[model samples]
Target chain A: MGIHLPSLLPQMQELGQALYERSLQVSAMIPKAIKALHSTAELDHSNLQSKIKKAGNRWTGAIPTEETLNLTYPPPTVPQSLHVIGADGSQIYPDRHAAAFYYLINIGSIVVSHGSGKAPTIQQESQLFFELEDLYDEADHPVQNAYVNLRRDVAEMKTLTKIAESLAGEQTLAILDNSLLLWMALQTGGSTSRETDRTLQQYLKLLDRLRSSKTGLAGFIDRPRSVSVLALIHLAGLPDDQINQETLRLTPFRGLTDRAIFTKLLAPGHRSALFISASPLNRDFRTAGHEVHFFYLNTDADGAVVRVEIPIWVAQDPELLNRVHAGILKDCQTTGGFPYTLVRAHELAVIPPQERAALEDMLQRTLLGHGLRPTQSQKALTKQLTGQRKQHTL
Target chain B: MPESPMMIGRVTRCSTRGFVGAMQISENALPVFGSLCQAEAQGGRSYVVGLVYDISITDDQFARQLAALEEVPQEQIADGQINRHVPVEFSALAVGFHNDGGFHQALPPQPPLTLASVFSMVSKDSVDFTSQLHFLQTILNAPQLPVDELLTTALRLSAQARPEEERERFLLQAGREVAHLLPQDLTRLENILRGLRA
Candidate 1:
C-alpha cells in the first residue's frame, strides 16, 4: 500500500515539534561549547593528547595542535598559477538477480588551472568487477554494499594520486569529496578484518605517493556531521578524574554537531584552527608520516561551513595550506557555495537509472552474440512487473 | 572539383517529415539557418536530405544558476560552454532523398536512424540537388515550419552554390516553382517572391 499522508499527519507534526525543540537545545549548547573551547584554548598540545589518551575514552575526538582552539584564519591571497584537481567517485553494487553479477566503480576527476582563463581538463575511468574472487568473500557469499564502497574509496584515492603524479611541474592541490581517512573498511567488518588491513595498506601507499609528488591533498566534506572537535570540548568540560567510559559514551550536547559551533565561530572566507583526528585508524596514518588533520571553513558569507581534511605535510606548510584555503574559496565563489570542480566531477561520475538499464541491455546483447540466452531471475522479473506504481481509476 | 562535406551533427530524433540534429559547435559558431544537410538511411542505400530551419541552445537550472551569480569566472564559463553535455539542437525539414544516383524531391522511404551522422552537402551536391527545383513544393507546404522564410533562405543558399552567371536564372526558376505550388495564395507568393528578390 502507498503511504497515506493524512494518516501520517499527526506523527509528522510531533516529529516537527520535537526537531524544533531539539534545535533550540542545540543552539543553547553552542555557547557552552564555545566557552569550553576558550577555557581550554591555552592547554599544551602534549597535555591535551595525554589527557585524551589516559582517559581511555570510547569516543573519538580531536587532539589540539599548537594553534589555539578558537583561532580563525582569514583566506590568504590565491597564487596566480594554481592547479586544483578535484576527484569524486560513484559505484553500482552487484545485483544477484540481473543478467550478470558484477559491481562497477567510476572515478571522475577535473583539473582546473587557475589564472589561465581556460577550460578545465576532465577525465573518468570505470572498472567492473565480476570475478568469483571479487563477488564472493572467504565464506563464498555475495559481498556486502560496504565492500563496494571501500573499493570506490580506494579508486578515488588512486585516481587522484595518478593524476597528481602526471602533472609534475605545477603547484597542484588535490581535493576529494570525502574525508582523507580511509575508515570505510571499518564498517565492512571492523578494523581487524584482513580486508581492512589490505585496504589501509593500499591507501597508505597512495598517500605516500601523493606526499612524494609534493602535491598537496585535501578532502572536502560538505555539511559535515563530525563532532570530533565537539567531543574535545566535551572532554575539556570534564575533570581529570571523572573521565570514565560512561561519561564518554554520552554528551550533554547530544543533537549538536561540530558544524553548528564552527558556523558561528568562523567568519566568511575564514577557517578554524587545525586539529589532529584522534581515531585509531588515524594512528596508522600518523606512523606513516601522512597524519590526517582537519579544519572547518566558512565557504561563504552566508555561513556554509565545510570541513577540510588534509595530510600532515599540507597542514605543516603554510603556503600549501593557504593555496588549499584560497583555491577552495575561489572555486566555491564560482558556484554559489560548493566547489564547482567537485560538482563537475560528480556529474561526470554518477550513473543514473537509465544508464544502468542501458548497461544491462548491452550485456544481454553481448551474451546473445555469444549464443547464450540472458535471462533475469524469476524474482527479479516479478518485481519489475509489480513494483510499478498503481494507477488510480477515477 | 567538389568541396569537402562539413559535419553538422548527428541525428538525435528522426522521422519521414523531418529530423532534429544537434549542431557540433566549434569556435562558438552554429550551422547557418536554411543550410542544406544530409543523413544516411536504409543502411546507407538512401540519403535523407533536409534544410536547417531552427537552431536552439537550451539552458538548464545549472546554467541559470551560474548566470544568476554576480560574477562568473572565465574558466567556469568556458567549462559550461565546452564540457557540458547539453548540446545545441537544430531542427531540419526533410525535403528530398537521394537513391540509385538520383535526387527525388520527396521524403525518404524510411527515416534516418538515431545517431546517423549529418553533414552539410558539398557545393557540387547542393547544385545537383536543386537543379530540378522540385523540392520547393516540400518546403512551401510544411505548415509547421516558417514556410515563406525557409523557402527564401533555401533558395538564396541554392543560388549561391551555382556559378555566378547562372545564379539569377536559378532563383528565377525557384520563384516559378514556388508560384506554381501556391497558385491561389497571391499574398503569400508575393511575400516569397519579394523575399527571393531581396
Candidate 2:
C-alpha cells in the first residue's frame, strides 16, 4: 500500500545480485589471506611485535596471531552430568522522547541440567535507572551510551557470579552471548573511563568467583568479524617504521574480515587454534591473571563459524575446552545456529516495545498523580500525529 | 474460625457476568476442576462467590524447552522439579454475593476490582452458600454462564461441604429446584441431575 511493491521488484533483484556477487569476491580472497596469516604466524616478525608493544592504547582494532595454521577438528564430547549456565542482557536505552530520561535493564539466566531430564531453571532480574545519580555522572554530564552499556555488562557478570555462587555440584559452564574483551573501553586512548575500570574490577572479581566455583566461563560470538589474526597479516609486510595506528590502518588486509577466512577453514565440530585477543582491553585482563583467548568454532557448516572466547582457565583445560565445544555444538543443533540456553535467556530478558510503551504510560500517570505534568517532546508529538495520519492513509 | 483458604491469584480481567484471574498454583496444590472460590470486594463489605469453570495453564515456553532436554535424566524432571511459579488462570462466573449477614442468589452490586485476591472457598463458606435453594435461580437467571455445569458443580460441592447427615437433603432440594426452573426443558433438567448423580 505504501511503497508500491511492483515498482521495486526489479531494484530488489539488482540489490540481491550485487550482494551475491560481492560475497563471491570476498570468498575468493580468503585462500590467500589464510595463507598469508599462516606464513606470517610462522615468521618471527620482531619488528611488528615491538611495534605492537609500543602501539599502546592509541592503536585500535585487533592484533594478529602467530599460531600454526593447522587447527584441530575434535569430536564433540559433552559431559553426561554437566550444568550449562547461559545469561543474556537486554536494556531500554535512555530515551529522550520519554518524560524523564531513564533506562531499564533486564538480565535473564537459564541453568540447564544436562543428563537430568527436567526443565531448565530460569530467572530474570529487572532494574530501573531513574535516580539522579544514575541518570548523570559525578560531573553532572548525562550518562552516555557507552557508560550505560558498561553498566549492563557489569550487571550481567554480577548475575552470572551470583548464579555460580548459589549453584553447586556438577561441573558448570557460564556462557555469555557477547565478546568478553571490553573493546569500547579500550578505544578511549591512554586513560580509560573511571566507571569502566571499577566495573571491570568487579567483573573480574566475579569471573574469579565463577572460576572458583569450578565453572568455566566462555563468551560466545556468532559470526565473529575480529581478525586479531590480521595483525599478523599486517606484520608480514615487513614495515620499516614502528607500527602506529597510522601504519596499521594502511596495512594490506583492509577490506577483509576473519569470518570469511574461518568459514572456509573449519568444518563442523572442528575448532581453530586458540589465539589470545590483541584487544587492548585484554591487557588489564592479563595483568589480573585471566588472559582472554579465542578460537573459531564451526558449530554448523550452513552458517558462519563462531568465535568462542575464554579465560586462561578454560583455554588451558582440555576437558573444559572439549565440553565447551560439545556443549555449543549440541545446543546449536536445537536452535539451528545459536545455543538454546542463550535463545531462551534472550527471550526471557528482552522487553518488547509494547512493554516499554506501557511502562512509560505508567510512569507518566504516576507523575501526574503527584500533580506534576510530564511534558512530551515537540518532536515526539509531531511523530505521533504523522504516524496516525500515515496509518489512516494505509 | 476456619482454616484460611490459600490466596491463589489476583483478579486480572473483571466484569459482573464473570472474571478471570492469574493464579500461582503449584503442581501439588492445584484446585479441583470445579471448586467454589470467593473474592473480596468493596473493602470487605461484601464478597463475590463463583464457580471455578475454566482453567488455562501457561508456561508453554518452560515446557517446550524442558521437553527438548531428551538427554536430561527422567528422574530430574520427575523428582528434581524445583518450585515453579506456573501461571494457572481460571475464569469464574459470579453466582451470588454475601453482605452483612445474608447471601443473595444474584450478581453483586459491584464487580470485583482487578488485582483482587481470589481465595479457595473454605468448606464452611460452601456449606453456608448452598444452605438455600435460591442460588439455583441465580445460575438459571444468569444465561451467560454454563448454567447446567455450574448447578451440578455447586450442588456436588455443597453436598461435600455440608454435614454428612444433610448431604442427601441438599442434593434432593437442588434436584427439585432444577426441575422447577427448567420444567419446559426436561432434557436439560435430566442432564443436570444425571451429572450430579454421577
The whole-model C-alpha lDDT of candidate 2 against the native structure comes to: 0.76
- Global lDDT scores for all candidate models: 0.87, 0.76
lDDT of 2 by residue, B1-198 (tens): 767888877899988877888866666666665687888888879888877778887665646666675553453354224435457888888888889977876888888899998888889878777777776786677666677887798789879888889888888888988898888998898999998889
lDDT of 2 at A45: 51
TM-score of each: 0.94, 0.78
Number of the top candidate by TM-score?
A: 1
Task: For model 2, name the residue pairs that clash.
Answer: A64-A231, A64-A232, A115-B72, A115-B73, A116-B72, A116-B73, A117-B72, A117-B73
Q: Which DockQ-derived CAPRI band holds candidate 2?
A: incorrect
Clashes of 2: 8
Q: Candidate 1, TM-score vs. the true structure?
A: 0.94
